[model samples]
Target: MVAEADVSGKEAAALIFTYGTLKRNFSNHPLLQDLILNGDASFIGTYRTVQNYPLVCGPYRVPFLLNIPGSGQSVHGELYSVSTDGLSRMDELEGTSRGHYERLPIKVVPSGEEMEAKITCAEAYYAHGSYAMEMWKKNGKQGLKCYTENETIGYVKRKDRPQHLTFLDHIRLFLSD
Candidate 1:
């Protein structure tokens, strides 16, 4: 369910999971730049879809995520908190009105942390209905297979090593101080 506004007239922040161009430093990053900077956000988790989905290259070589499942690979992505207005702008850019994509809730778990709190539910833009089918047809099953299997494409593989310094690193620095 979409997050509802609070009694105080402020909308609850919506958590959105992104695995493609919407990611930081990507082509579409600017669309969410302000929201990400102004809101409470973090790289909360990484997860592969329980089912396989198509990640095909569209016109201009931009990748699109199709709704197909059971392809047997884990997809990785990040989650961010957004205001209702930010979500609406994202919907417009994603062509939600034209049915290019649909926002659907999904489950994800943190890659390295063993804590139960790391598992979360957030909304994501999945290629919807005929949009997915048409993209798959245009790209062909073989093409989709190759892209999903051989290429990282839209996935962000979790690194075994943490991207940020750990407590140990900070402690060591403190000792040297």
Candidate 2:
């Protein structure tokens, strides 16, 4: 007798967790502009914000979160559910794989109600010595707090200054790999 084959359905939309610049008023945030001018994507409501920066996972050779909140107090952010093709566009927008940052799997929401989402992780490829180390290091154990206690959403104050690492530097490191 012949047996039937099992099939799986396609994934429904890609979810992204934004923390630093991707939120509302980060210095580099241009998503809203993209929506108005570029028309690249839209927002969803299925992600959680944690007080942590991206760290490299030795096993996957990728970056992942070191700390995240499990309850109370909402960390400010927006959940973007984009089309499959839009992920490529988002990658370009986020500079993923090009060394500025990368994408990785992360859980969203403190309640664990929704499924996991993709987050922009800082690349270890930037670890080109002490200079790069300095730029990529995270001081706060519970993810560096980018906002003060009284700061409102979309207006959080960054505890540190933004770096101006050029595309040339990123290209050099990534190409060397």
Candidate 3:
């Protein structure tokens, strides 16, 4: 069910769990905010993944929630109810069409509790399986349950990155230092 919708009968169609740049105050949050402003989405609340997943940084300090479970920590992030159009917009931005990220159903629970037995089903963008493992390995196999905005290594916005290189190439260059 749509958590919230607009007056014109356009209702949210999906629950999205956001754990990276799309979260509020992050580089790509403007897109999500736009949807919210236009009444195509509504913030549900903060939640933590029901299972552990590798949340790691890759090219340009971009965060990737690797689908490999039971290896990292249960990710903490915000949830949003999104209209079909809003989900499409986010899909494009996340590069789902180009395989940079893939939308997958995940289980989450509201935060600030003692791990409730009840779990909510939501969809989240995870790094594509084709390359997620390799990227995690290249990044020293480290992961975080929550992606802190003030990363110790720093974060780079998309516009600031070199336009000539593909994202995978950027991944290779990310840890050269």
Candidate 4:
């Protein structure tokens, strides 16, 4: 059987849920805009996860959808349909290989239509499994109903952060900030 990550739109586009920076007008939206302009992705609509999930910010104010199921709020986000190449690019951007994030299945329904709408399972990027729990602890165990960090203290892009520091080092810098 083909691995889930390898299964893509040879025939059908994959559904994706964006809970943080990838949402419209958020920090990382330019990438999605490029995908849309190139016809690699299409916006489905505003959607929210069916179950509660912790949404927190780590170093550089990066939003993390913690993998701890049923622990936070029914987070709202955007949904999209992406072609194979689109999925691949998103996976790369999310750093699945580097363990920055992991793509996992999540159930979402149209925003404001929860009980009346059909639930759809889409793939969403979450905090890396190895550090998710620890990250939550570092964030004072706080959970936001939505990801709106860009308006206050903003996210620093990975490229802009110090190139040589380990993630733990960055975490230290973040705490000091």
Candidate 5:
């Protein structure tokens, strides 16, 4: 079961649990750095998700958390406290309206030695469809291999692929076809 944190005044900043691109030094980090109160935030819980989902690299070569049941491996990521505006910006970037992802509240545990006693309820951007997995499979096994080998880097730019496909567009097409 998920534990609930005291989210009263002065501690109500929305918590965000990120397991992919939004992590430090990744491509999307710049968008969140200013909004993150703790750059050194702790991991939410164990690296596994409640339901299996593929964590694959999309056509953009960026790592995407696919919401495919029974298809993911144990994954690691960070947690941050973001203001309301920050959440909006993050939603925009994740294409929440366009169905690239869905922002949902999740239960998280503080991994910091000093804060281990607290459990946080946070929101996370989870991949909403199978496009990411399809794109990853189409790219061959190389992308998956690289991601597994190096968990520190969340996004990878593929010089060979054109930037014509936006992440949202890819998902839309996949769902329609």
Candidate 6:
């Protein structure tokens, strides 16, 4: 569900669990440059990140939440008090209209709070299953590791061909952060 605006930034901040192309310097994340410039945003390093492909799993599906159950290791990202307009744009970019993904309620680590705060979370459409395990076996540790480390995303080098298709090629390259 979309969170009510009654919750202020100090009370809560929206959390987006980005395990794939949403990381900075990757795609249209530049549009969110205001967050970095305004000083209202900060990188919170305390959420789990995971990588998944919709084409392989199924069309228009959010990747299953992995790494931690409710909360876990910090998935590298920044949190900001985006304007309602900015958020509306994000919702559209995230394909919130599609049944595959939705903005559910979640807790974000406030800038200087002891506990997580209430916020909206974009979550996957399916039950948490063993897709990560399958990916690990399919790509081995190196490919899986590369995907997770936020290094050389979008493209995966082929071990045999030395040149090959990558995640970017197979999927719709994310157009927004």
TM-score of each: 0.64, 0.45, 0.89, 0.86, 0.61, 0.41
For 129-148, candidate 5 gives per-residue lDDT tens digits of: 54555654554533231243
With a 3 Å backbone cut-off (N, CA, C), the pairs that clash in candidate 1 are 48-74, 48-75, 51-70, 52-69, 52-70, 52-71
- When summed lDDT is taken over every stretch of 10 residues in candidate 3, the lowest stretch is 1-10
Best by lDDT: 3
Query: Rank order by lDDT, top first?
Result: 3, 4, 1, 5, 2, 6
lDDT of each: 0.58, 0.39, 0.83, 0.81, 0.55, 0.36
Instruction: For residues 1-177, write the lDDT of model 3, one tens digit per residue.
Output: 334444235777888999988888788889988898888788888999988899998876789999988878989999998998898899889889887899998999999866765688888999988788887888678888888766625787778878998776676576454
What's model 5's overall lDDT?
A: 0.55
By TM-score, the best candidate is: 3
Q: What overall lDDT, based on C-alpha atoms, would model 3 receive against the true structure?
A: 0.83
Residue 98 lDDT (model 5): 81
Clashes of 5: 0
The clash count for each model shown is 6, 3, 0, 0, 0, 4
- What TM-score does model 6 achieve against the real structure? 0.41
Better of 1 and 4 by lDDT: 4
* Angstrom error at residue 130, model 4: 0.1
Model 1 has an lDDT value of 0.58
Give one digit per residue, the lDDT tens place, for model 4 in 1-177.
112222223323578999888998887899999988877777889999999899988887888899888888888999888877788899899888877789999989999994568988888999888778887787777787788754337678878888999665775566556
State the lDDT of candidate 6 residue by residue for 1-177, as single tens digits. Answer: 333222235222343444443445544355455543543233334342232232122112222223223322333333334445555555655545643245543443433334444332433222123243333233232222112333443343223322464333323322111
Candidate 6 — what's its lDDT? Answer: 0.36
Summarize candidate 1's per-residue lDDT along 38-90 as a digit string, tens digits.
55233444553433566665543445666666542445666666677677788
